[model samples]
Target: MKKQTRAIASTLIFAMLLGVTACSKKNSNKSKKKFSVATQAETTEAPSETTESTTESTTETTTETTTEATSNPLGLKIDVPQENCEIQFLPEEERFKYDMVLELNEADHTVGGHVVVNFYNNSSEEWNQLCMRDYSSLFKEAHHDGFQEIEVKEGALTEVTNVMNETTSQALTCNRDADVSVLWIPLDQNLKPGEHMTLSYDFKATIPLVADRYGLSDGVYNVTNFYPILAVYEDGKGFSHEAYYNFGECFYSEISNYHVTLTLPEKMKLLSTGVENTPANADGKNTYTIEAPCVRDFVFCASENFKFFEDDYDGIHIRLVYDEAHPCGDTMDACAEASLQAAKDSFAAFNKAFGKYPYPEVDIVLAPIDAGGMEYPNLIICTVDAMYCLTNSYESFPYEQMAIVVAHELGHQWFMGIVGNNSGMEPWLDESFASYTEFVFYEYLGVEDEMELYSRETFDLTKEPWLTSMQANGILPINRSFYDFEDADSYILAAYSYGKIALYQMEEILGREAFHGILREYVHRNAFTNSTSSRFFGVLLECAGQDNADLNKLIEVLFDI
Candidate 1:
């Protein structure tokens, strides 16, 4: 975990017919006192009692135990007494047993956080508990089927409240560096390792106008954290818990197969993270499954009045789902084609440069939400209005914005998807790297000189004071929190503007051949595993034979803070 600067949130006031208001929340901040520990112990047996009063007493005893365990603020624990379940990336059908349906409230823009995972535990041990680390900060005990809330001390958990009123609360007993929870206990009452268990819990999430995790605007549903996805419990990274993360730290996990079935209204159209297993008009329902393996978590979108289009370019299936009656229909088509082209270019370049494209199909859908674009494996949910609304006048807007935005998302197929990153700790690994890759696609399109010329021209044209003031000061380092100041531009500068400049500078320093080799080798080395800035910089240093570079300083300056 790295130190981060504070993020300043800004509200976007767009006067659209749908009463849309997309706000951007920056993740930035630093905390000096935070820590965790690890412990190993035998499974505690459910103490038997002689009377109902004894059962009540036992419950009280458990509560007291939890209170005592959490009395020390620094006391938390991570234990792996035994491995009860083994999760692997198999074909979607073989890996998943049921379609995950998340019921969301359109009125409040909240999600039904109930997770029903029908998975099999193939280990031979008797599995009793499902361990999951807490990611959000404001969680209440959810009363749902097949679940129980193990009580811990108050204020013992961290709250993830980036989205107003929507935070996942965590209460851990030990002073473990990471916060974790047993989402479901006893894989099953009479469960053997190879048997299956179905766990379901009802939850509610706060939907922000501009949500980095998940949100909705108008009919467009940006369904992130909509379902209860499993956390990465690995050997080295541990339970993947860092309760306080700024924009710098994004996410860390290995890509697993996703077989999700989203149930929405009959009037809605769906766009998700995998190939559509069912036809578009499958009785107004869309079912998708991954045809190839994905290396990260899944994301999806749903909307009414969404028009669909598809193109099979060089065996890669590309689908564009958006509003059909949009005034920018032609621009939408152009963007769709541009997205496919970017995918083609990225895959071709990445394969030739590093490894192969792991997934078989990719989808790019236009979301109604106005919070810019978000990337998922084989799919990207971006706001159509925002992409087309760059210019003051529709006629003045060029189609290049569409191309560049699409290219950025497509770049994630490598930076974020194939080559896994702990976004919460090293956001540059995804955003900065992805932005740089988009620039590479720009070069592939023979627009490198054109884009750079425009950049130089703009640098000269823009006022220095304005640029300096616009530089982000609210940038918290990765794995840190946006705990201080409020300068929203830091989010853009760190992830987009300065990040692009830094990568371009790296290219100049390493030379084109070695630069590309370093990137390719970095992806190859860390594919399907969480990687950090030092690891990435080390690759560059190895290729460039440079030491004492103070790579972290480079990232800090990227925000121009």
Candidate 2:
């Protein structure tokens, strides 16, 4: 992901909502004293018991076919184990499930919805209360980004009703943090590990007129993070609650199932995270039913004036929603077509390099967003200016750069989408690796010039404001929280820029096939799990075989482990 601003001339996509996996095997070649394996976040943690997820997704990538395919899809020349379901989950347990019925009022830019979430205690920690992140509540006032001023009025969640825990048939008290964004609802009974609970609530929010990830602008609504979501619970940490920052993607979540029924005004084209079953239009409203399984978050964007384009490649349906509301329609047309083609090419490249995108369909919305691109489960929001230079009309950003944006966002499908993480704490797990996938996309297509160009994008990070302080402190740490950076540019530099180069450096040491094989193993082992840094390094050291000083030094230098 890149960071672009509200305007096109200042096109610096360094605002990439950068978004990781590790494998379990043996200790790294580096001795116990050499690497901080004991302090690694994933060492003592994993989600639930080993249970087969009843995924609605069409992807069926078996370990046998993925690792031992005769065609050598992943050029690794090593033998790998054939095992699935690495994480823990009980057979009777249910994956997190959210059932929502929402209605979008275009005239007032308001949405009224009721959500019923059914979930179990997957962690070892017992739950006396539930913690949730109400992102909409974070926008209580206006925000300024030096370049753009977002004037917000009544942008918060104005109304909430019927917060209940259905398990005990008890109405619950919804407590709020100081910011009023994190909700602490008292559970009627203690939710022990493996115990289930059902929560129901109704909410309403007025969408502010902002062109960012979670607002409405130019008649299009970016309805992301508009509802309260379950905050991930760490074993000893209770509920993970990082303050919402003005920069980077700080949202973290567990993979869950979504069944959303949305009602929209007539002619509103909906682009959402899950696949749509069908729609019934009646009484000037269109009601759509969608089912998304094993997804981190559920979001949807709607535009009544979108010029839509679609195509199918290898049974995966691709849709491109172009905002016709943009001033440069004819010029945007060429860029739109290019982006659609980029999506197809990106899917093909990533499917080969990583793993098959499990969802049957993927939607790329070309909207007027502040950032270059933001990713969801099956949908990606790209800046309409992503491909074209608005000021110069036909003259566009290098075609390869546009393709890289699409590829980077799609790469999140593997990093943040398939494998989960606490993004607020470890942005690079997704962002930097997505940046690496940008190189892999180009490399897979044999486009060395483009690969060289993309690799150079992360160069020269010392000039960023955050790096100077880091150098002064004598450490170059990539494991930074959203609040740790000096600004958006500094965060972008570290997470998106320097982090990718770190991976490239590792690839240089590990060899492409060996690294790719490790990645394949990582995905095969940790898919749908919140992967940790130590686990990733452990896999790398294990694959590099008993003696990889270069890999250890790189991790030490980049992450200060």
Candidate 3:
């Protein structure tokens, strides 16, 4: 398996690699709404000593006004503690190490607690910061008022393995758009350039009863916004996170080591974020071990019954697990295979088109959730039943539906996974592209007019002028946009309809060879780095050269802001 892949370039992206499996339960919907908290008493020595040492640690409460710009996406919020927080994690547990570790410098203090951030180098030489919306629900109903400031003597590193006092809760008590005080800890710790360090923290998250957009249904974990993952930090061009909350986009993160240990009921088998290192074991309980390096955040889905189907593609081991009892089993399998094939095809194409596949394994699962599909690094979770309903109008699985959905999910390997976009903002970047590619599977299979038919089906949804560029009807970010969709319909429209149309148009103007050549060049250059629509257009325009007026016009109509 070519696991040494480069960083993806899109801001609108799914979390790290996603794995797929099916579980049988009343409500298989995974929990998306969650809140985490971890607490710790400082034991590590301060880097510096100050007169404040004589004062009671908990007695002082610093006050400062917090000003935050409204986020385009309405749901989440990101706040970083100014005081340097020492983050921690180990290989033994499942959840992340901590909420944050704060080393307060009287000179570099923040309003309250500093937000803990984990960074990763997708493919770039430097690490980028991720951006998130504010979730102030953490502030209210807290056992601890705020953080206890510790003086880090100049040049000394103070480590506080902080944990959240509140482990479970959904939706911030604060409004989604509300601005709250947050502390930011700079990764630019005075350490020399190119230096790496571990920032760990612990947090307790409550699975919300109703995860408005992303949360728990019944007891299953359909989680996404469980913790305060880091936000992208910009040099000057605003946040590296995307501007519009479109269906797909690129994201940035700081590179750091992740050692997550989650403690849960022994009856549960955890299908988590990265590849598994330790086999499931019983110590009066059952647990699986995982170790991922340079991951931004950890995500896991635990279910009692995970029907695992394992296979290998190009010598790379792939596992597809899901609930056998699901109504859409036959369709799911077909889609799964198609998706797998598409992924392999995309990888092969990328090698010729762009580069090589990065990781050793790719996992695809069928979540019992309502939303159709979600993509992570090597894993992707797609709602099989919903997928069946969205594209396969027939009650049964048709070869075409299987091919299209599978191809779409597989397309994520390039558009979303390898390219890396912020799914929260630029929904179209990867979705549309992936959709277009998904239909290409038909062409590959020698289906008649498959691309045209697929394009027509997709465009039919957004053909209305109101749907283009209008906030109410225009595409929304992947993360928040799912709300607007009832099933898998939106994905088809975004990925195949708009994205395919645009890509096909480009190919027409540039010639298939030249159009594909531009893609190859763009992917090769970006490899693992995060990118945006503008960047893609720039590269394509350059590849197409100045002689192509049609290409230029198409670029303007489709991508010009």
Estimated TM-score per prediction? 0.59, 0.83, 0.58
lDDT of 3 by residue, 1-561 (tens): 001012221211221111011101101332111000000111222311321231122112111122122221311122211211111211222222323321111122111234443233222234322234323233232223111111111111112225221222111222122222122333322222233334434333333333111333333444443444445544445334332211222333333334444444565555655565544455644434454433444455554555666644433455666655555545556555544544444444343333334344556666555334665555666655444455653233333333344456666666665565555455566776675564343333333242443232344323454246423433333223323433333443443345566676566555554555566556545544455776786677565565676666555544444
Which candidate leads the pack in lDDT?
2
Across residues 1-561, which tens digit of lDDT does each residue of candidate 1 receive? 111112222311111110111000001121111000000110122322222332243333322331111121211121111111111223343343323445445566555433454555444555444444433322322222111222211212222221110111222121213223223232324445556555444444544444233545445666654443445444433344544332333355545545554445557666666554543446554433323234466666767857777654323456778666555655566655544544555554444444445444667876544345667777776555543445422233323334455666777777777677666555666777776765565444433443443242343212364345444354434212222324335554555544555676656544554566566557656666567677876665554554425333444443322
Overlapping backbone residue pairs in candidate 3 total 144
Highest-TM-score candidate:
2
lDDT, candidate 3, equals: 0.40
Q: Write the candidate numbers in order of decreasing lDDT.
A: 2, 1, 3
Would you give me the overall lDDT of model 2?
0.68
lDDT of each: 0.46, 0.68, 0.40
Give the lDDT of residue 158 in candidate 2: 49
Model 2 segments beyond 4 Å from truth? 2-78, 81-94, 144-150, 386-389, 392-398, 449-475
